[model samples]
Target: MSDLPPENVQQYPRPPRIEPVPHLVVVRLGGETIAETTGAFRVLETHHAPSYYLPPEDVRARLDPVAGGSFCEWKGRARYFDVSAGGQRAPRAAWSYDAPSARFADLAGYLAFYAGLMEACFVGSERVIPQDGDFYGGWVTRNLTGRIKGARGTEHW
Candidate 1:
């Protein structure tokens, strides 16, 4: 509803693309503010909702490194984090790439949160919907078009 054009995830790039999010991004949980920033990046991939990444300096919650690790071809190796705020804990609810691929070098040390694990996440003034399923961490907001990944039948997508 803002002045931005609608994002069609189906048409997103295969290797993923990063772009600056010019809106205010905020993460809140258990009545406490987890992270807030006007400076954030959105990663868009095919058949997926955009994932917003915030800088470490903007995160106000506690992030404890966890054991699980994963590798993304475009983003490189990722490490998990257990986020704690307002006395509530969500295990491995966030992740960051300590060293990213050259294409995503700007994402180094940037934290991306699971909207489903938070009380609420906001992009600009709109509250976001968490993408379905447990396999993907995407934030769904208004003005996004096309079929999104992380849904029940989207496992292979």
Candidate 2:
């Protein structure tokens, strides 16, 4: 268990902040482990669960780049990736910011998986609950507290 205080999403920053995650992060799909890493970074934003980004080198499966991209005011351009393993494919299930803004430049090349699209995702031994909707890639764990964003009516939040 971590000695740090319990995290409440409500108290996270509006612009978001990145923190190093020492726990093991794992992504499972198509009945196999596609990615596993002890080194992960999480982006914390107000009203949202943490979005964990794994290093590119730690990912086992090949991520095929998708056509579209998006812009994050804080992070810069976001690129999509399709992940496949064991005959299952999740289109645009992952994303990365190649040219992030200076403040978030550390996120460059890190991949954040959509837990809902994968068979399972875990933080250490605890299975994570995916943040609602396909838009945000946050992962909700048992240790978190507060009303999270991403539900239908919370679009403006």
Index of the highest-lDDT prediction = 1
* TM-scores for the candidates: 0.95, 0.94
Off by over 4 Å in 2: 1-5
Against the unseen true structure, what C-alpha lDDT does each candidate score?
A: 0.91, 0.90
> What is the Cα-based lDDT of residue 57 in candidate 1?
98
RMSD of each: 1.3, 1.8
Model 2: clashing residue pairs? Answer: none
**Candidate 1: tens digits of C-alpha lDDT, residues 69-128:** 998877989999999989899999999999999999999999999999998999988888
Compute the lDDT for candidate 1.
Answer: 0.91
lDDT of 2 by residue, 95-141 (tens): 99998998888889999999999999998887889998768889998
